[model samples]
Target: MKRFLVAPLVVALAAVTLAVLPGSPAAAALIDARVGALTFRPDAPGTGARRLASASVRQDLYLDRVSGTFVLDAEPVAGTTSYLRVTFGHLDAGRSCQGDLELRTDTTSPSNGFTRSGRTLRLVATERRFGYQDWDCAFAVLDLDTNGDASDGSVRSVLIGELTDVPARPVLAVTGVQLLDARALRLVRGVWTTIEVTVANRGRADAARVVLRGSGRGVQVRPTPVGVVRDDDDTTVQVRVRLTGKRATTLRLTASGGGATASRSVRVARAKAPARPRPGTYRSADGDTTFSVSGGKIRGFRVRTTTRCGGYPDIPTTTYNTYSFRTVGVPRNGIVVAKEKGRLYTARLQLRIAGGKVTQGRFSYAGPAACFAVERFTASRRR
Candidate 1:
């Protein structure tokens, strides 16, 4: 098995186009929040609070996962301070929130209050509550929905001072993808292969509903769903893929969840061709039964029976007989049917051939009382 380490590549969050909502104050106009790099807000959204310092908002956001940390550096305001209110003007319909807003605060001077509505999240750091200013806060949007959907986007990050969207440090990363059988065996063309993907949760909080999917040219891979990855731990999931091409190809894999997404790509060599089975003589363990194969056809077959026939136990005086027959070309499934007839009896033979050998055969005889009723046997090629 060959494993490919996947560097955590930050997938850009889906771009959202925003138009200024009617009647909103000029300073608080709805704006597009494209967070991959650091975005600075120089002016506060409204009257009460000051804009956050440069690169103060760091956000890690996904379709259904979101989290971030913020430094709300501002002068003390006397009245009800509108510290931060996130306007999620980008979310689509049918998108609802789950998981309580987990906001960890570092300062006690100004008590914080969080509220969520249809598409807006408001964080209030009011002086009237605790008489504090200039604090640090971190939060994560635990679950976007009970079931994750790429069509929905949630709170990227909640900045306590200005209206900005950001994400937390990346959490779940696809550290490696292993071609389960690549090391010991070359992948055979048109054959299904199993691959294992490793995912690690590198953040403080647990990552939920992580799913991994793979893709490649002329190849097929099944998607794997990983429920959760606890903080600082890792897990592996197995997926089956089929290579259909003869030339080399690259397999791309992606792991996404918990407001984070990571991807990796691996190059796979051309698949090997199948080998044909050799033709030879095969015999049963007792040497009483034998089959001859040549040019993929059963050339000769024989079985000598000395046991019970139609419930007649073996005895010194029991009649013994040998039946022999020649068969035509073998079927694709390796089944052969032949018949032998005598003046007073008829014999039918059924044999299965596989892996250069004959196996699981049955012989049926119908005639006088001394005839053998049925016989079962197996045979392998002599090396």
Candidate 2:
């Protein structure tokens, strides 16, 4: 149950000869230079025999060759297995070619198996034999299978060549962020605004399980999850934030993945005083609904609605109706209730008046044992 993960460590070389002289060719290009070795151990009690003794790797750029050796501290008991992961620094030169990798080992029975993910290699080894199982990779992996129950020693020498298939390691960077909603330009205190944030990934590989975080004074941001973003591609996500105070502020958004992070900020300003409700016939932006307002009442209110209940069609049917309602609060904002009621639901409307018109509103029809949906809309005074 113990797992050891060896991260890639860079081992700097002081000098790399590149020039070719008579009868002597230059070494292969050092596309990647890094720490080339790692070791793992088993910590679980009563499992000392299953621990990894040691591991070593070497790279000879001139011959395009990579080699490694692995040994277990002791022979493991039957049915006992240990898992280990090791990462070699930047071994990929291009896209990962699991098929281009050629593997060889000493023992083939009681086989140890291994798999590759990106540059990280996973191996399952026991006391007998460790060998490479079928896997795609961008780096070298030693698959060992110890010959029949050898209680003496488990030593593996892996000779691997054809190292040209490794891909360039993928780099993740948050390229940019864009505010897709105009409401973000002017934020109102104590009101929640849902804005669209477009997160872009300019990377060599797809970013998985991406997350967006927002921060600011007088602001409350809802952390958003943005799933896989393919290399060079972008995805947009919605973020809901509330400004709790009148002070102007800025909202900072950051996206991170693959050890890289990027951030962008948006300016927020206190909203101006709201304009009074203007008396006029207003039409919804969609032109599918309309309502008229006079000082303290809403008239000629019309919208589509649906309801489903016992004795009604399984799928709610749609219908349009004209309604009249009295404002129950301030002239700028109030709830309007219709006098008529159906057996399954009652109709109600909430309206917000600003900038000389009915700026936004919600219409709902609901009751016990019924399905009622709230429809939200915006309308401007008809010109």
Candidate 3:
């Protein structure tokens, strides 16, 4: 069997463009964290300086638009042990760099065909001296597939998941899900596989909104959401996933790649949209009447409502537990309300104060049928 990886080179234009484009329109926007900045260190015991001389090699790695194909320059990190730790970090907008991944050497060559197992990337080394007894050598690829800032997170914390089980007992992960309107897709069931990914975004200002695409014997994940993380002024990255088996099906999760790309260490069991109005106080203009809030507390309610479905049309169906209040500086405990066509609502409003001559205040609400529960007492702050 022959390995087929291109030589790894220094940073290329593709990487540079993604990293150094702050004056452009995307400047004010989110730059891809994976290509933000990059840092890869060669760690060896103090005694292995001899091996270091033979392996101090550099490579230019290019990630495809979808985070799948990667082209490494035709060179190896100079001489030495087959077990050197290769770390790849992401860089955000500035040139600030950070570590992203560390690969273990098994049967490494100029060209390598990598296999993915669950969330791990595996490559068998032909050199048996590296001590890999199996038919092939293995390495893990870390892909967080999230949306925030990767570099913003500390190196120790960000790469914690990646650091833990480098020599992992491969497990399949649901990298992405593509909902097929096709009737055939609906008939399929559970299947799995692994994915090696690298993202490329035309614009470096933000994480590219790209999705992962995969095909299985039967089953699929529909519209997987990817989070963006900005790290390493070198926000550029390459990640891999392990997926379980499904019937004949295809699943995809899109993300901005390259300067637009964002990668991280992620663990996903499964994702699904949450249900509405399962068990909570509800207020609605038109729906099945279920629950309500009453008493003075519901009247002095002072909290923002979310169930934010949309605009006015959404408001009528909003299960927001609206309450009115008279006195400020009172501790208000909020609750969940389902959107239902009802008359009154319920709430609990609390007021804390020390012993003193207290003034009487009033509470009132003139909206549709509003109700509340009110309780007053003195709560001394801990000394």
Candidate 4:
């Protein structure tokens, strides 16, 4: 949709007399104005008679006895389109003025449908069409004989008004509720499962201010009162719940708004804990290094390396460095944390494994005389 702002030019008028005034003597002191009951009736000839649907209008203006201006704005309702006309009555009393206005986003000067007779002004902004549903128009009335400065006129009356098309009533339905991860359907006790609830609006008009709610035994739902669901649209509400009981359980979720409601359920079963990796040797992609785990604990690392020294064999020589690690925390979330110590250095390592394989590992070491090194490796279990 196109969006534009319409601001009316201020009118400064030199005093002039008029035979008829719009409202009353009090109209001169009026500083505010408003439009009431702005409505639109589809003028399309032939598709069964339809009720007049109300369209929203918003206006901003400065008014007084001698001069004023107003900007009216609105967006046409979705679906049907017809001639949308706006009429203002008893506006800016005791002033003789003219208006130049345009509808939609047309850049040319507005040439038709703006007229003032007695106390009322009427304008047919545009014929509503597809992709041209939004409109903003400015209306200004100035005293007849201002010598070019708008602020010189006596303060008259100001009118700001808005017309909004009411969206059709909404019908809410709970489309589905499923675990974010299919594997999480069988939930383990003491663990959290993430699920999503799909809410759909099956109505022609937009739905406003919908609230979603969920309930179940032995479960805690985070983020209650899910936000709104629009018309002919669907929104997913994410819920994270921790199951405390071991047996099977069901979760019920409901979406309610605009005098309509829907509900759905998800069933979860108690499952055994995931199995830990077997304690064995795992070799890196390169054959020069290997890691070993025993009794669910990471124990040792062996690396083949070449070093250069002046007094060794008078050249670079190959050597083997083997370091033993002391296992620390029990495995959790597929990770094992441990510490390795050597005569002159100490190191901390974290190893991550999944599906019976050591996917990656890292270690950091510090030694005397400020020696330090950090390394990472990826490995798989030996066949």
Angstrom error of the Cα, residue 205, model 2: value is: 0.8
Compared with the true structure, model 4 gives a TM-score of 0.31
Candidate 3 residue-pair clash tally:
126
lDDT (10s digit) by residue, model 1, range 1-383: 11101111011111222223488555522222223222422111322123332222222222232323333344323432333322222222312111123332212132344443322333443233122111122212221222222123321222222224332343777777654213322345666655567899877566788888888897777888987888779997766666777777877888888777778777777544433335888889999888778787776777888644444365424567777775756644454555677899877776656676654677777776564556688888896
195-287: candidate 2 lDDT, tens digit per residue: 667777654566777788889998888888887777667886666666777789998888776555678777877765466666778788777
Regions of candidate 2 where Cα sits further than 4 Å from its true position:
1-184, 273-281, 284-379
The worst-scoring run of ten residues by lDDT in candidate 3 lies at 156-165
Worst 10 residues of 4 by lDDT: 1-10
The lDDT of model 1 is 0.50
Compared with the true structure, what per-residue lDDT tens digits does model 3 show for residues 1-383? 11211112122212333344355553232212121112232231222221222211111121111111221222223442122333333332433223433343322331233443322323332322222211111111121212222232211111111111111111122322212111111221122222233343333233433444433332343433333432322122222233344322243434533233223332333322122112224322222111222331222234333222234434433345434333223112121111212245323232211122112211222233232323222121111
Alpha-carbon deviation at 312 in model 2, angstroms: 44
C-alpha RMSD of each candidate structure in angstroms: 20.4, 19.1, 22.0, 17.5
Better of 2 and 3 by lDDT: 2
Q: Arrange candidates, best lDDT first.
A: 1, 2, 4, 3
User: In candidate 2, how many Å is residue 116 off?
Assistant: 41
**Alpha carbon lDDT of each predicted model:** 0.50, 0.48, 0.26, 0.46
